[model samples]
Target: MKALIIAATAAASLVSTAALAQQAAPQNPGPVIPGVCTYYNARLLAQSSAGQAVETRMQQLAQEVQGELQPYATAIQTEATALQSGGASIPADQLNQRRQALQQRAQEAQQLEATRENELRYTLGTQRQKITEAVSPILTALYQEKGCGLLLDRESVFMMNPAMDLTDVAIQRLNAALPTLTFNRMPVPAQ
Candidate 1:
């Protein structure tokens, strides 16, 4: 009976100690330093004035190039089909001429596609640079205002607090800072 009483008292003391330790444990007060990190969705930033304008022009250029290339595509296919079916009875001179023509046509189509791709790529590059230049200062100001130690693209994060997102606010500031971008010229790369 005495042993049982001692065991029960020891168990009660252990329970009280555990309860005290739990009460003394620190709470999770979110981040060590609030607003130390922030995230923004880049795609969401595309709704800005400069970004919207760039996107519209990019779409228009794509449609225009596709329209221009359609006829050439058809012509090349027709020429290829004709060459395949025309037997050796077709005069050697005529055959050579047709072959040369097909070669030239195919080259023209490739060159056109390559040129259009380069042009669009250059335009998009310039548009991005212009917007970045405009948005940088404004974004820095925002980061300071929000007490952000680090800012990152939301896509890079596994999960984040909604309060740490700065995309909408950044877009508004960027639009006001730069409403439009001159995009056609390729900027010279630094050596």
Candidate 2:
């Protein structure tokens, strides 16, 4: 009886394993309307060729800014170290002057940082606008080509079928149309 029960348990386990193995993986649902409506994923902009170029350019600009500021930082650090080590030996008036000069240098460095940040922000915004301008016509052409009567921004939707996504096609078209974008640190206009 014990042997028979063990054999039955083994058979049952094998049968369950076989059933699980036969089950199919979940498939993506098709679009509700094959061509009448589609969605564009705006978040996918970063994956496009132009977007990549912008990112690379931004990195280069950031590195340049760091290089430009490094000397100012080193000078400030050197003066600060000198003041900290020998401030007691200096005459009162001279010490005060040195402290004030150090403070002024720090303030200047801060101002330069703010200015560079503003320039970087301006450059980023302008580059994004250029990319948007380039993408707009491509999206329009895709809408027409797909016979889509309704176009939805992916951000605005709650849920969507994979078939309705046009982001990949849009990126492909964008790569073929505008491969790379060139941009510079746009000077921030005086407020």
Residue 116 of model 2, lDDT score: 86
TM-score of each: 0.71, 0.77
Expressed as tens digits, the lDDT of each residue in 9-118 for candidate 2 is: 55456445434543531365544685655544443356688877876787788778888888999999999999999988999999999999999999999899778877
Candidate 2 residue pairs that clash: none
What residue runs in model 2 are displaced by over 4 Å at the alpha carbon?
1-26, 34-43, 156-159
For model 1, the stretches where C-alpha displacement exceeds 4 angstroms are 1-33, 182-191
Cα lDDT tens digits, model 1, 1-191, are: 22323533554564465446547645642443466555443443356888778767766666676788889999999988888898476898999999998999999998887766666666666777777888788778889998987787755654445567677788887878888765453434445
Model 1 / residue 186 / CA error / Å? 6.5
Lowest lDDT 10-mer window, candidate 1?
1-10
Best by lDDT: 2
Clashes of each: 0, 0
- Model 2 lDDT, residue 76, Cα: 97
